[model samples]
Target: MERIAIAVFITGASGLIAQVVLLRELLTIFQGNELSVGIILSNWLILEAVGSYIGGKGVEKIRKRVEFFYSFSLFFSLSLVAGIYAVRLGRLLLKSLPGEGVGIGGMLLLSFLV
Candidate 1:
């Protein structure tokens, strides 16, 4: 249906935008190393796949599918903003000075957490 198509398009567009914004924020946190790109992207893909799997499995239990879908979409958008905020705050939590590189282990942990 036309509504489904539009929803899908908006979801995809918003997801891509969030990914880019997160990547940029993460690159700054990790000191912009080339390896950070691979780590960030791989972690992102893995998390997305896991979330999709979990959502797919749980979706059938919902009685009000349309309302649930819209609510989940809103939650996703809000979570993206929260995620970016978290990434920015992580530097202070980790006690790292600005422009300093987080080592591989720290980068992995931070990326996975975020």
Candidate 2:
């Protein structure tokens, strides 16, 4: 297979897996509430938009560093897996109080990190 095809497959697989893990984690954290789902989706789109904007502005500069991009992408995928584990453990460690859920600031931070 071509290198580009391999890269695309890896990227797609990582993204889909992360999305499933994140959605499951968020649903658990938010007690499976529908509004929480919306919040997660909105946060995802917002962050994605920001990434797109930044990538658009720096595409030329980024193209010059393909090796760096590949390295970073590898690290990112590894981190996502670790992050999923951490989130699962964190949910157990940091149990939500009655009538409490993830706040806006926490959601924003989670969205930014994830």
Judged by TM-score, which candidate is best?
1
lDDT of each: 0.87, 0.73
Writing each residue's lDDT as its tens digit, candidate 2 over 1-114 gives 597788878888978888988889867766777776777788888888998999789877765566876887888888888877766665444555645786666655554555
Runs of candidate 2 exceeding 4 Å displacement: 63-65, 89-95, 98-113
Per-model TM-score on C-alpha atoms: 0.91, 0.73
Clashes of each: 0, 0
Off by over 4 Å in 1: none
Q: For candidate 1, lDDT tens digit of each residue in 61-97?
A: 9999888879989998899989999998989878889
Superposed Cα RMSD, model 2: 3.2
Candidate 2 C-alpha error for residue 96, in Å: 2.0
- Cα lDDT over the full model 1: 0.87
